[model samples]
Target: MTNRGRRIGRVGGGLPGIDRLFAALLARIDRGLAAGSIEVTLPGGGQRRLGGRAPGPGAVVDLRSWRALYRLATGGSAGWYEAWAAGEWASPDPVALFELFVANRHSLGDTARARFWSRLGRRLAHLARRNNPQKARENIAYHYDLGNDFYATWLDASMTYSSAMFEPGDTLEMGQAAKLAAILKRTNTQPAERILEIGCGWGSFAMLASGRGRRVHGVTLSAEQKRHVDAMALPGVDVTLTDYRALDGRYDAVVSIEMVEAVGREYWPAYLATIARVLKPGGRAAIQFIAFDPALFEAYARNVDFIQTYVFPGGLLIHEPEFRTIAERHGLRWEERYGFGPDYAETLRQWRERFDAADAEGRLPVDLDDGFRDLWRYYLMYCEGGFRGGGIDVVQVTLVKEG
Candidate 1:
């Protein structure tokens, strides 16, 4: 027997009552899934089908051990990931399963969420990783400072990390260019007017804006990113290693692409306030962000997910309505919002393909292990599935500072 199989035997040996509990839990999942379906092959050659009530994605899973379900029940998404890493479960296409779960999140309710004690523990752990200035820099380094070469292996030539705005027949590079153009247009700044880019990733927007005869100042917390940007030496652009809160100069426009998500929910007000403070009166700030459905925000905030646990330590998806309210409070008028969730899904799909190809060709960083690669691949698929499910969305909005 494999280690997972041996462990399953031990768990099954002295746990008749717990086995019944696991059965009940599986039944709850079946009842909760209002859309799509899952074909499950259990240990000991048992088979069970779940969901199938409505038309949606179909998935298949092989439960290597009942401990998988137990971990899921107690640890939520993070626990489920651990179970997968431990080989306690196997799925032919885990992305479809993620999509099914997110698509039916409303009906599924808390069926997939962490229990009280687990939720409390995870929440506390997340809070400890909060984005105070020092911690914020650490969090940024944890993901972005993985070396520019590491990202260049998989990302498009521009090294844009956020979701690209795709059009029919557009390559990843073209889509990213489109996104940058759209954001720059939203700024509506004259050639001579100054622009500020917060969390500039490798200076894509800065180079684009500078090429157009606009002076651009880009700020970032990641030293690696700053070094990369500095090396470019774009004549009309300057890159600084600085926090948004420490920004001093006033600009005619500000553009932040998918950066607000890094500013913890607690710091959202400050983020908006900084935008309002730095923008010249009547100037616009273009922001691209990912937001979770308002109805599900409360529950999501209560439990730490896989992304928060492993990928981006201090990250939180925006709750749009509340975020809009906060922007208004900071005297920034939220306007001209555009959502392209399907585009983000496509972007993720293409990125995953490129990442897989890089891995297959032995082009990824040599220092990174198989485990890290697997974690990253899983993260990409999980995000792609979330976008496909439609509960989470990517949006661009212009926030004009009130004069």
Candidate 2:
């Protein structure tokens, strides 16, 4: 038996009346399943295949303890996922297991009541984690200050952490470069103009822009990132550990990549206003960000899933209609927009593959504990699933200040 299989023999949690509970759970699963198959191996040696799709394969999940069932029945998707992460159940094919849940939406708590409460909970969660200026700094530090070495394991040499523009057979590095070039082109940046990047990460784009002999100012809250940019010592690039809210002076062009999500919904007006306040007349701006469709935005906000809790504390996604509303409110005219969800999904796949390989070779996890690694894997895969499932998208928008 495999280690996971052996685990089933020693774990506990069966009461005299538990057999009824197990039977009912199995019966409900059997009823709910329509396509795809799930083979459940209960503790102490009884196996049951509950459902199957005619030509597709299924997953084999070995429950090491009765806890997995309780969590699934009571806690919903979060509980079920946490149970897997906790080792209460073992599935050699995790993606297949997730697919089974996807096939049977009820298994992940897709009831109307669940949906209602989920939206309420997500709104509350976002408010609780809202980014006031000080909280914003703390939140940025929490995710970005994990040391340059950690991100270096998964990100490309450019250290660009946002979604990339990709083509078939394109490498992650090439896609990142493409994203940068696309943003610069959309803004119509010129070497004689002044450029301001509101969330310059590690100065990758800033350095690239400065190489064209333009004066580039890249500001961010991440001190470690500032250090990296400073080390580059690019004469025309000014990288600072400063907040965009504190910035002053006019620029010929502006750009921010995937940073608005962290600005919080309540502060979006201020952020957009700041862009308007600092840009010269007729100046152009380009921003790349994660966006959602408003139809599902409310439903999505209600869930406030694992990503919000552990990865980006103050982040909140915005949809396109909402983005246009706020931009128009602040007098920023939207010129063009492009969606890059599939590209982001592909970028994440590459990162996860590289991370797994590096860790397997003992190149990563230098000081990170086992739980941290698990959290990162979950984060990466969860975001990848979100993009692949079409729950979210990344967009690059060209805006003009009535120029």
Instruction: Give the worst 10-residue stretch by lDDT in candidate 1.
Output: 2-11
Cα displacement (Å) at residue 249, model 2: 1.3
For residues 1-403, what per-residue lDDT tens digits would candidate 1 score against the true structure?
4222222223354665886677678778888888788888887766678888789989899999888998999989988998999999999999999999999999889888899999888889889899999999999999999988889988899999998998899999999999999999999998878999999989899888988889999999999999999999997888888999888779999999999999989999989989999999999999999999999999998889989999999999999999999999999999999999999999999999999999999999999999999999999999999999998999999999997
Model 2 per-residue lDDT tens digits across residues 186-293? 778677788999999888788778877778889999998998899999878888877778889999999999989889777888889889989888888899999865
- The top-ranked prediction according to TM-score is 1
In order, the Cα lDDT scores of the candidates are: 0.90, 0.76
lDDT of 1: 0.90
Candidate 1 regions exceeding 4 Å error are 1-14
TM-scores for all predictions: 0.96, 0.83
Please report the candidate that would top lDDT against the real structure.
1
The Cα error of candidate 2 at residue 151, in Å, is: 0.8
